[model samples]
Target chain A: MIRVDENPEDPQTVNELIEILSIQLNEPVMKSTARLMIIISLALNKKLTFTDLLEITSLGKGSLSNHLDKLKEGGLINIKTVFSGMGPRVLIEITREGMLAYENYSKILKKLLSH
Target chain B: MKETPMDLSDHLKKVGKEVVRLDFYLLKRAFGVYYATWAAAIFTLTILSYISGITEQSDTYLTLYGLLDIGVIIVAVDYTRIVFRKAHMLSRLESDLQMSKSFKTIGNNVNIGILIVLIVMFAIIGTNIFPGDLNSLLTFIILWIVDLYVYMVTRISFGKVQPEVILAVGTFGFSNTASCLEFLLTGNSVYSFPLWLVTVIGWSISSLYSFYKAGEIHSTEIGESGSRFS
Candidate 1:
């Protein structure tokens, strides 16, 4: 029942860390690592266009499309469309689950790397 | 199975740098447009002074302006292309980043302030410039139209912008307006220390409006490499 914030070296912290490690290591969610990075990056922004992702990731259209579709299907991200005078623009934003997954992934990654 | 050739840490650093580069590139582009537009304005005024016979006796001024025009035109074309093709992009990026100090209204505010300066200029100098009262009024109207043209061109090249673009553009607007106001204030008809004080007050009004909002001044960040020229 120890809060992770309240105590650093409590046995509960180790148990919770181990549980987090196992969930991250074994879960099908965010297994690709690239997808994890996508979520993490999106977490840092309010929203990103397909073009933004393309520039930041340097991934080709087809490859980026495949990843985006998978993320959308997994409910980790949402692809919304808006119409401008020029044309329709697609905006990608991370969902709550995506944000939580990223936060968890980052915490675990930081802890593991620090060790 | 998807490829996992690289580590997340490496990807983070690599992506991080690319975004940083893009941010700096955009900041530089915005600043470039602001400056180029200023140069264009100078060229315009030189043409005006020459046409109006104000600088008729000043060959040196003409030659200097002509040389400066050459450089300004060259620089302006590149900056114009970058800015016109990419209006509002900088604001969008800052919005995406959820930057708290984003000065979204500064561009519009600055524009309004400059228009005020033009209005004051018309009030003070309209009679001398146009000679006849009716001609003066007509000239004032033309001035409004021309100012709008210049302002819109500058706006399209760099408006609804945020972060350093807003700061740079807004500062340019104030300085341009202030200097122009100073010319009017220091005109022989009303030239005096009191008017100079009014000019300083005029500058403070525009500058304080632009920089003091957004809760805290991020002009400090304007110098950050994120604030660095491209």
Candidate 2:
């Protein structure tokens, strides 16, 4: 929702910004803010319970499952069922590929903001 | 398939806030349990040591103080283990390096503390470096120094000086150090500023505060229940 009306005076800087945006947009999971928020939480915490993720993203169960499926299909995360006294619980953890992707996104964002 | 309406910079800023929030939540839970444990240990053990001293049971008093030192070190190492397991479970969080170093630092500190305590115990029991009259005072000073060192290392590990820690350090540090100084100068123990009272009051307050903080943290919802980030 934030609008950046003032482009950088330097042509090269504008080009760099456009390139960063394009790169982010091309990534299927990275392009969505919801998935990025989930990734950020996972990347920082390593593993989180399904309830933890639910509280974090505030997404509905079905919608959250869809996002998780996309993230799983992209090989960015792994989901495993854990049985406890309460019952079966889903635990999600970020993969190495997911971590790298998060790092790349972070670096690109930092680079863009610096301009 | 759905594009974010926000720009890249906005996305980063928003996600960054969530990251910090999650990090704080996990640490708060871990340290809440830690503070509560220490509160119980200090309150009970200090009272026992005080009783042993008043009963003229010199051996029991010394043993209790030694146990307190060892017990505290065990707690410190246990906390490190908890954090280590959390880090290992997460696999590759950005804070892993700092946590690994904290484990080593806490390990080295515990070893050094134990070595010092053992040497002091040997000198007290076997050698004449410390007179019989000074046995209790010496133990107090040693325990004070050990507590202070542990507090410093804990502060470094946690990256912030929590209120529970400050309360403990202030209470034990002042009471023990002042008692030793008063005994050294006046040749008599300060009955009015007894360690048992100080510990009971200090740890009671600390435990209450820590439990309250923990309760507050658990009550706060991390995010709105139905609002989607997208």
Candidate 3:
């Protein structure tokens, strides 16, 4: 039976982990967990309603709208309003850029966890 | 700048936990809408059947029922489309994350369960095995089981007890269960159409309550993690 250690104390391994962490920490959008979550959700869902995002994030409307605007400005997401019998609803879709970002983050996180 | 590898690992784990929490929260809410829609369909059908039988106006009931059936179908199809689209999006992801697999599994199982239950319920009704008009009682029993099953699934999957869902559905189920027990005790036509109608309305109200509770979560900012931007 093999026992798994929590954090390998090898100097090189630690340095490598630290370097990966540092690189990710330098990214502005990746600095915040909230933004990362939004991207992950949008990436996985492609598109979701504003209310659906609100429910997912558990954030206030104003704050969520602000995050959406930032994502839109970053070319990570697009926000649109469509009208139906139930009235107009906002739809948030992840852009190709956003999906790429999500993929990168997920890869980094998985690598970090493995170490 | 002085963070150790262990510290960074903890941070990454925290973020991952928060993301998973939010995803599960969204899923639970979606299930609420699903349950409400199904309850509405069942309630509407029950009411239509009762009205047609009482009024003896087959023509008007047929027209109204046909239109309502169409409406229900449209709504259900719309929900199916949304769910499928989301699943497709997840499938398109390059990395085979464990979280994604869990999400897809839950989605597939829930939907498949719905189809199976619908088909079985329809089959039972079509058979008309009961001697008298006790078939309606079977429908109520099935609905009660649905409520209990939902409660069980939510508890098992999310690891949190949704008391409101259980409470609302429980009240209706309790009343109907009592009705069934009473009928069983005395071999009589006590399970009348009016009683079934009342139980159907109760179930509908319970569904509305579930919808209200589910929708209520998003209206306000919850927890510090939710308000990180603010």
Give the better candidate number (2 or 3) by TM-score. 3
Ranking by lDDT: 2, 3, 1
> Which model is ahead, 1 or 3, in terms of TM-score?
3
Q: Going through the candidates in order, what is chain B's TM-score?
A: 0.33, 0.52, 0.55
lDDT of 1 by residue, B1-230 (tens): 43232343344334333343343333343444444464444445445444534435577776876676567655655554554324333343332233233343354345446656765765666356545544534443444454453445344333343344444334444544544465455532212233233333433443344334321323233223221111
B1-230: candidate 3 lDDT, tens digit per residue: 56554565566556555555455545545655655565566566556665665676767668978799778867865774564444344433322334344544564566457657856985787698875546766765676766555554455444456655565466557656766765676643233445555545555565565556645554443433563432
Q: Evaluate residue B228 in candidate 3 and report its C-alpha lDDT on the 0 to 100 scale.
A: 40
Predictions' DockQ, in order:
0.03, 0.18, 0.25
- Pairs in steric clash, model 3: none
Q: Candidate 1, residues A30-113: lDDT per residue as tens digits?
A: 233345445655765536788766654556678778888877776778999988897999999888867666556445333333
lDDT per residue (tens digit) for residues B1-230 in model 2: 42343454455555555554554555555555655565566655556655665676777667867787678757855764565444332323323222344544554556456546755774674565767566666676566765666465446534567887688678777767776776777776533335545754675676667667655654563533222344
- Kindly report which residue stretches of model 1 are placed more than 4 angstroms away from their true locations once superposed: A1-33, A109-115, B1-230
What residue pairs are clashing in model 2? none
Candidate 3 lDDT by residue in tens digits, A36-65 = 668878776678899877766777799788
Q: DockQ for the candidate 3 complex?
A: 0.25
